[model samples]
Target chain A: MEKIPVLKIGNLLLISIQTDIYDSQGLQLQDDIANLLQRHSFRGVILDISSLSIVDSFMGKIINNIASISLVMGAETVVSGMQPAVAITLVELGLEMPNVKTTLSLEKAIQFFNEKFNRETDQDGSSQE
Target chain B: MEVLKSKTLKISEEKDLLNIRGLIREYAGEIGLPEIYKVKLLTATSEIARNVLKYAVSGRMTIRILSDIYKGIEVICEDNGKGIADVDSAMKKGFSTSGSLGLGLPGAKSLVHVFHIDSKLSVGTRVRLIVWRK
Candidate 1:
């Protein structure tokens, strides 16, 4: 019954997962993301997982699902602020969150998003002129 | 068995799997266990716990911290499910009946200092994992 809040910043959607999410909660999050895509004009999503201390394959798959769903909807997804422990465990398990872009921190992810957004906007602005 | 604290959790549904990882992290943090070892224990517990739920509808996990020469965590997950027919094949990566990433058993074993598994046909499966402070 836990609800994760998704914040809207400009053309970007931000989701910060703060706790260990259950199966139902993860699925609910995916639903929420899908709904948001329908309601807004989002160009990118940054999932902040700085507070999550555990990253099992099951959890990794959920994050990957979110990223893929977003990608299919024409939006870029980046997971930011992964702990060293989580990163090492993911590698050692012979598993990775497939198809999702990962960044070291939220700041870097936003910067990356901005650069991509700017290039596309600048090209669009000039192409019409 | 110089046990400092011991606890058991029931794993019956997918929702319950989260508890397994949370409990391991809590216990590891309480002991001030190193970050690497804590992640190891948490990851191992996650793999085994998921296997229990995937293979069996219900299972139990017993976790204990021992005060031996060095502090260590002992996790034993037991389930009365269909049981693994081929232990060796099951242990091999990419060999799964449920089509998991197929690294549960092998990955869990690699993360712990000690690993043991016993499965009987038409009976159940029991897996034990131990991680000591480094």
Candidate 2:
């Protein structure tokens, strides 16, 4: 009933998926997030899924889709703050997250991205040397 | 002595999923799983049931209370639809032919204590998942 919230912090967009992240809702939400990523051309995205108690096939697919699309858009996606129980469930389900990054907290994720950004900038600056 | 089973259309319909969720919840309550655990079970069941309805045409799901001592629930979802050609690959996360996020089987497997799946090409698929409260 409650719509999933999407927030933008700097170049990164945070999509707070509030539901169980299973079945049709999960698919729909993934599509919405993908559209947002393509439309806005964000540099990074964090799927804050701490609210989801369980991760099902549909939800997993959405996460995978987002990660895959982010790469195409030149944006990196990170999934942060997944419940341990949910994580365990996902492993047992045999869901493999290939290119997506994962973090324990959003702050840490942002920091990780910031570091990458700085590193890339430093490399470019030194190229002239 | 609690059991529930349902026959439904292909895996895309949402109504069949709702019915399956209700049934799983009732059984979870009867088995006295903690509220948090019950919610997890409900979500897991819904995901798998939806897959059965969507991927396999005319599937049936059965949930039964295993025994009093163990306080466990076992669910079997069987469908004679197009079978999964690669069971191992299908079990992998983010591996979906349908362009979905591909978390359904993996997610359901994560929620319960024991999860097993079997599929034969053109023969359909069957999944058995078990959760214990004790």
Most accurate candidate by DockQ: 1
- TM-score for candidate 2: 0.69
| Top-lDDT candidate index | 1
What does candidate 1's lDDT look like per residue over B15-132, in tens digits? 6777777778788887789998898788888889888877788999999988888888899999999999999998887788885678789988888899999999879999999998
Alpha-carbon runs more than 4 Å astray in model 2: A1-3, A121-129, B1-12, B15-47, B57-64, B76-128
Model 2 RMSD vs true structure = 5.1
Off by over 4 Å in 1: B14-19
lDDT of 1 by residue, A1-129 (tens): 868888999989999989877767878988999889878879898999999887877777778888888988989899999999888888888787667888999999999999998999999999999
Instruction: Return the interface RMSD of the candidates, in order shown, one decimal each.
Output: 1.6, 4.0
Q: What is the DockQ for all candidates, taken in turn?
A: 0.56, 0.26
Task: Give the least accurate 10-residue stretch of model 1 chain A, judged by summed lDDT.
Answer: A53-62
Clashing pairs in 1: none
Positional deviation of A88 in candidate 1, in angstroms?
0.7
DockQ of 1: 0.56
